[model samples]
Target: MSYAPSTAAGKQTAQQLADISRTLYERGWMPGTSGNISLRLPDDPGRALITASGRDKGELTAGDVVEVDALTGLASPPGQDRPSAETAIHAAVYRVTGARAVIHVHSPYATVVAHRATATDAVTSVRVERFELLKGLGLNDPTSTDLPVFPNWPEVDRIADDVAGHLAACREGPPGLLLGDHGITTWGDSLGQAKNRLECLEALCRLLVLSQSELHVSRA
Candidate 1:
């Protein structure tokens, strides 16, 4: 489908997202077409531009983005490219946290930690404490916090709804979350901040996994 031409600001946002997507993809965090990134248009807070569905993250171009309603996640111009299936989740984060950018990635450590943390289906959050990297999240209490983890419901909208509910209740919570057996989502006032927080959280997950492995070996 032909998309409406983007304004200069929109073009910049798209390029920024494309650049970040390729960087993450090259790091193996967004293998295949598994991740999506978005930015709320500064001039129109009610609208957002998100990565289009099924495009290889490593090769995204400025034209690969779709402008969508921030709340409904519908294409804004009515016939633009289809937004990612997870667009609603990005919208929810923007609405709840007033974030300027949101990133979702399937990095190995974060995904593995999310999977293990949710081994008990009823688990709701993953607790991390005394991790200096927590400062990167810009949380009210970075020394320790429970990062909310939602079930990776098969229906993307259901996950979005749950995210909205949790974020609404925890207004001062971490700027990121985990999806059971899925991956991590992070947001920030800017794309650079969001990417930095994502790296911090993923590193924390890596440390958690390594510590667990050390404990297991000692026990064995």
Candidate 2:
């Protein structure tokens, strides 16, 4: 799919997004075409810069970013390679949280926890608490927040609505979200903060997995 040319500033922002995408991809957070990243234009609050559809996260280019109407989720210079299929979900997150940037990736830890939680047939959300990494989320303590995980929906719009509702209902939780057997979505006031929060969540998940290991040994 082809994407329309972005404005000078948009191109710059797109480069930044592309850079972050590559970094995250190298870190194994967003592999293949399994993740999306977006940010609101610095000057215009209603326009968002999002990754074009199906582009490899590891080799993202400025052209891989498309400008879309924040509220309507429509591409600016309309064409193929339309914004990520999950653009609506990112838009919903921005509108609901007043955040300027959002990152959604399918990492192993988040996917496993989300899937594990789903298998229990209990609640749809996953909680990570009492870890020192909690401070990475800018929290005073672990009890202050939980990651909200929602079941993936075939209809993207419905998933977006559910995310919006969850954000509304839980004002204290971290900005990270998980789609069961899908991936994790996180955002913040800026691109840096958004990426930071993503790293924090990923690190927390890794620690959680490690903490569960009880290696038995006998003194030699």
- Judged by whole-model lDDT over C-alpha atoms, candidate 2 comes out at 0.78
Runs in model 2 deviating more than 4 A are 1-6, 119-123, 140-144, 213-220
- lDDT (Cα, tens digit) per residue for candidate 2, span 1-220: 4444446767678788999999999989888987999988887878888998888999998778888887667776655566899999998898778889999998888777666555222226555666677887866566545676676778899888888887887777787887878888999888899999988888877776677753221111
Window of ten residues with lowest summed lDDT in model 2:
211-220
- Winning model by TM-score: 1
TM-scores for every predicted model? 0.93, 0.88
Scored by Cα lDDT, where does model 1 land?
0.84
Our model 1 lands, by Cα RMSD against the true structure, at 3.9
| TM-score, predicted candidate 2 vs. hidden true structure | 0.88
Report the C-alpha lDDT of model 1 over 143-176, residue by residue, as the tens digit: 9878777878888998898889888988878888
